[model samples]
Target: MKVVYLPGPKSPLEIREIQDPQPGADQILIAIHYAGLNHRDLWMKLGQYGGKKEDLVLGSDGSGIVKEVGSAVDKKWIGKKVFVHAAQDWGPDKNAQGKQFTILGNPRQGTFAEYLAIEAQYVYEIPAYLDLKNAAAIPLAGVTAFRALFTRARLKPGQKVLIRGVGAGTALFALQFAIAENCAVYVTSGQDHKIDQAIALGAKGGVNYKNENWSTTLQEMAGQFDVIVDSAAGSEFGKLIELCNPGGTIVNFGGTAGAITNITAQRIYWKQLNILGTTMGNNEDFQNMLGFLERKKLEPIIDKVFPMSHAEDAFKRMEKSEQFGKILLEIKS
Candidate 1:
């Protein structure tokens, strides 16, 4: 088995041959077909997420076929193609929920290689319509958008949504999702080109946020949004707040821009706004996300993919945020 491990903060991720992981009592072994790279992978590589200093595998989203089952898992699951929920260990403890380490990647060993073993409950059948390549891209970004919008923001059809960043893959999904539900979407993108790209995807209009008065433009368009999904968390957070309508919701999943923002008491109290934080989702959320992808025939946003041997190159591209969507690594025999 081949795997990637970040030896230390800002150090080069070393790919090495490691022993195949054995399935635990409630676990299953998956012959990984593909793994999706995300900004979180870059964060962990830079040791920005408070992950332990040792070696940490670098992925969360992956799809593959079942190779073996643990004692408690059903044998019927063996040989089935599936995508992992990726948040198997997102609970309070390492009980039936699996270990606390972010499974399939993160603090735990990941699926960057030949094989991975994880809790059976975290694995779900990939829709027959979707192949392994698309399934590999679903778990992290799809589930995050689903959970953040539906679960966190409780977004409803006909509402106005301002998707705060067109740069991240999640924003692409969020815009399309809101449009599907009849919500009017206003997209703010750093790049002017992405603004038109977003409109083509489903947004009613797009704003070039490079301008200092970008927030004002959004305010002038729809006045305010019932929901705002913000990928940027730096100084723009205050601007994101202004985009929110009274009694509206703003969901914060990742801070692509940067963290640390000034908060004003007036913004919080006057608007009666909801500030929600979310991460990788629950099994129910993952299932719903899968259904959404199936119903809409939505394709996973893949910017680029590299061979297993070029895994480091893949990481560097993601670290630089050079891609508009998920990056992938292909594993070949």
Candidate 2:
């Protein structure tokens, strides 16, 4: 099996031949067809996430065909096309994740290889509407967005919603899901073209966050939002608080921009606002996300695809935040 390995922080990614992984008693071995990049991988490379230095296969999202099933698994799964959920050990609780929950592509070897072995329970059949390339891009981002909007924010149809950082994968998924629910969706982006793209995708409108007093301008234009799905938590978080309607919810999943500063406690209490935090998701969220995609016939946005041999370039694109959607690495069968 050919695999990409990370030697350490500040070191270049190198390809090498490694032994193929075998399935455990409750696992399945998959021949990977495509792997998707996430910001988590970039953080690990920059030594921000403290991932293992040696023998690390950096990827969390992938779609492939089952090559073999473990003894305890049904043989019928063999040759079935599927996408692997990145979270593991989610346990039975739907309200929250278990203590042992872990995402793929860190301490454990991941899908950035020719083959990967994962628990059979974590794999979902790819919907007929999605091809392998697009299916590979859904697991991490889709699940996160689903949980943030439906589970945390409890967004309802016809409500006004705003998704911060419109160009990233999770944010785009949130926009799509909110729109499908018949919500009036708005978005914010540092780039004006991204805001335009979101509007083209059925968003009611959008604003450029780079502009001064953009939040105030948006509030006047669109009124207060019922829900706000945010990834970047910085000075803008205070603005987000002001933009939400009374009793509205704001869900935060990622903080790429840095720590939040100058939040007003009085506003939260006076408005009866809900501020929630969520990570990837529980297994229930993953199943619901898949069902939503199938029901809506939704397709994930793919900005570009790179051959597995050029995986380094994919990482570079993600690091520079140059992509507007999922960046995929295609594995040649």
Each prediction's whole-model lDDT (CA): 0.80, 0.91
Best by lDDT: 2
Question: What stretches of model 2 exceed 4 Å from their correct place?
Answer: none
lDDT at 308, model 1: 79
Q: Write the per-residue lDDT of candidate 2 for residues 244-304, one digit (tens) a residue.
A: 9999999999888899999999999999999999989988899999899989999998999
Estimated TM-score for each candidate: 0.92, 0.98
Candidate 1 lowest-lDDT run of ten: 92-101
What does candidate 1's lDDT look like per residue over 107-168, in tens digits?
67776877888888888999988888878877888888888898888989899998887856
Stretches of model 1 off by over 4 angstroms after superposition: 92-103
